[model samples]
Target: MNNIVPIPLSIGNTPIRKCDFLSEYFKTNIFVKDEFHNPGMSSKDRPAYFMIQDAIQRNRIQAGGTFVEASSGNTGLGIALIARQLGYKVKIFVSKSCSQEKIDKLEEAGASIELCDNSNGLQDFQSTQFRAQSFAAKEQNAYFTNQYYNTQNIRAHYRTTGPEIWEQTDGQITHFLCGIGTGGTISGVGRFLKEQAKAIRIWGVEPRGSILQHYLKHRTAPNAVRPFDAIEGIGRNFVPGSFDPQPIDQIFQVEKDVSIDMAQWYYQHTDIRCGFSSAAVLASLKCYSAAMRFHSDDNVLLFFPDHGSRYLSKLYAENSKVSTSNAHSLNG
Candidate 1:
């Protein structure tokens, strides 16, 4: 009798596949974890599901209550879907930077929408987060799913995603890479991998304009941090409470243009359309290649945050006009 564990095809159990195309091109064992398999089609589904459950377990909310949150897109949509399914009303505050597709989906999931100017480079991104808090304060039975500050954000990944990767990879993962946002995913997963093997390298990828790298160096966010550069969920002008930089081995920043090109290249070669931030992780690996520390046999996994459907209006709108040939070459 076989003792093999059947792979789960459900939320929080997305598949991790070794990419032969990427491994061949990069001359290393490159694996891509497809978070799009989640019901919300993104890694945000994990936290959204976990946080809401946390609220219920702790009596932070009850049936027919209201859920409140601020999101660039994925988190809000995830909450909206969960809240709707569990008989709760929801309100989502979004930065102008959020794509129309995400907003439409949030509405379809029965979320009352509010707009914040922070995402449009008008002010600090925290404005949206604070706005949601204030709104939740004045509303009846409104439980704020403060993803940015809530420790539950990290707990979600630590409890579920971290163990999933360890078990799925058979405890052989050598490196864990992903884009940093609220800092929950990397912090939770990175910390977990570190505990399993202190030798595991945790590399973080950041958008060029993101202040996370700046915060890591200066221990403070800049007063005039650059706004989201056409990519959502990865770049942050303010350091979120969920962000924990302790487990990160290195942080790589990539330009938006190059990240966009690589995302398309990945799709053309693999038929897997990933979100822009996830593409940034791919570009980060290219930058890491120059260091030449990674061996061909090392198992390196890149965590893709979400799917491309949420970014269709922006990142994938004119995909054909861009070519990856000039994007980033091993020689260059």
Candidate 2:
């Protein structure tokens, strides 16, 4: 792998594995997309690679100019990885709540980091986004690549992610499940899959407190509001501009412990180790497959969003209360 030059800038050819544990318990076939193999250790690498490529092609990024954006973790890592190889200066604004390990990785990738709202304790996603915007506004050469509003993020999924899944599954994919963050993964992939086969079921996984599930169930709500949850990388105070709510068949809200347990169990049982979002997705998949009892031959696909390595100190460390308690509860 070291001999390969420039790494070819491609997303992983992730495999679909039938979950033996889940199949026995639920009496149905269950499959997962192992996104941890992607370059940046998460599915976000797909969009990050393409987003930078598109920016270069369109001349949105001047030669040797600095790139700037804000992200929770994976997106920043994605941008920083590409910028380092391409010889561009990069700075990423991250929320104060983001893991220190992620910040260290970003800095290691040659990115300057700005901590957003560190003093005031702005833990909310919307507040952090607002702070990122405020910082972006003052930078002279900074390009605020809004992942939430950017069509490129969706286009990345539409052109690359969706095609890869469709081809990999050999058109046998009957249901799609993903952790919804920016809605790019769901919107783009869902659109393409629907266009290819209208029978496909697209479900978005949200944190327990997220409004997306509620919004999908009841479109008549007067206004959207933000709620706090332990889950990361999915759900926002408001719907992203890139989010297309119509194509979503269902939105499943998962508990924090459920996600933590699922991720830990996967790492323990399988070779794949992914972030909490992946666990939420697996939990959702279990629930969905159990209720629907998918046909014996039918294929059900779940997207494992990001790797859990970045969450080591918090999710993997012995001193980390969340993982310890979650493990205890699961044992109980």
Candidate 3:
């Protein structure tokens, strides 16, 4: 009998497609890393797979073991899908602020859900992370994939995502941009790109309420951080241990309304359905283009972390309250 391969094993090698519309509109070459093509439908699949595999290899977890984590949405979905495929039980402690679509997806993936009240703040122990940690501590044969602090998160992207981008762009990528979450994507990809070509500029995008902008500017975490904005999968009240700001050349702060409107516009115009965080990067790209004149030869790459399907209740909802005037002012 042949050994069965889990579906989650087929996670990486997502496609990088050139954005003809964006390129012509911006008057420069622009490419998008379509992470939505991943089996888990998000870039979170990369790190989640790596972390789980590493845990298994190190005997930290075994078959039929329990996997636990705290996430806003995408990461939990990735882990849940992978765990289900590998016959592991998954318990996700997610923020109550996460979209209904995401919660539904997680439940459909056969993962037990624990909704954490994030109205106060996400960084506190009373938040999702605390609940996840406490659950893992009490459960037998349970492994907590602490994505934020896990070095494996960065290593996953460095070994896979970074190399894939380097090869896909034929080592000619000039600028790489993405929204910062656990900082794994930017840090890992940035390190690899810079190692290959020192001139490659790595830009980190953050929401207005995120502490990353303040941290990047002041070289320290802020004293009093605000609640995480409506945008999910990116931004944090506190910097994660996995985050490495050293390779980032600059950080751009985008507003929640701007991200939502930009995402909707991108979907309408280019037919590329990206989530709010990805749109934040797009908005930042526009801001960056306005400030800096790009040569025709310059190649800019942006990572679209997840698809817009998971944002139906927020970014794509019919009753969603997005400011058209503000979006036009930014894009116009």
- Which candidate's lDDT is highest? 3
Best by TM-score: 3
Could you tell me which residue pairs clash in candidate 1? none
Clashes of 1: 0
- What order do you get sorting by TM-score, best first? 3, 1, 2
Candidate 2 similarity to native, TM-score? 0.86
lDDT of 2 by residue, 1-332 (tens): 11212434566576667778666544556677877777777777777776676667666666677666667878888888877787777877777778888888888888888887521112444455665666566866556666777788888788877888899888989888898878899999999999999999898988877777776777643274545465767766566767878778988878776776676766765655677777788767655555655777677787877678878765566533335545554433
TM-score-best of 1 and 2: 1
Order by lDDT, highest first = 3, 1, 2
> Which 10 consecutive positions of candidate 2 have the poorest summed lDDT?
117-126
Backbone clash numbers for all candidates listed: 0, 0, 0
In candidate 2, which residue pairs clash? none
Off by over 4 Å in 2: 1-8, 118-126, 219-226, 286-290, 319-332
CA shift at 143, candidate 3, in angstroms? 0.8
lDDT of 3 by residue, 134-176 (tens): 8899999999998888898999899999999999999999999
User: Where is the poorest 10-residue window by lDDT in model 3?
Assistant: 1-10
Instruction: Give stretches of model 3 more than 4 Å off.
Output: 1-8, 119-123, 319-331
Overall local distance difference test of candidate 3: 0.83
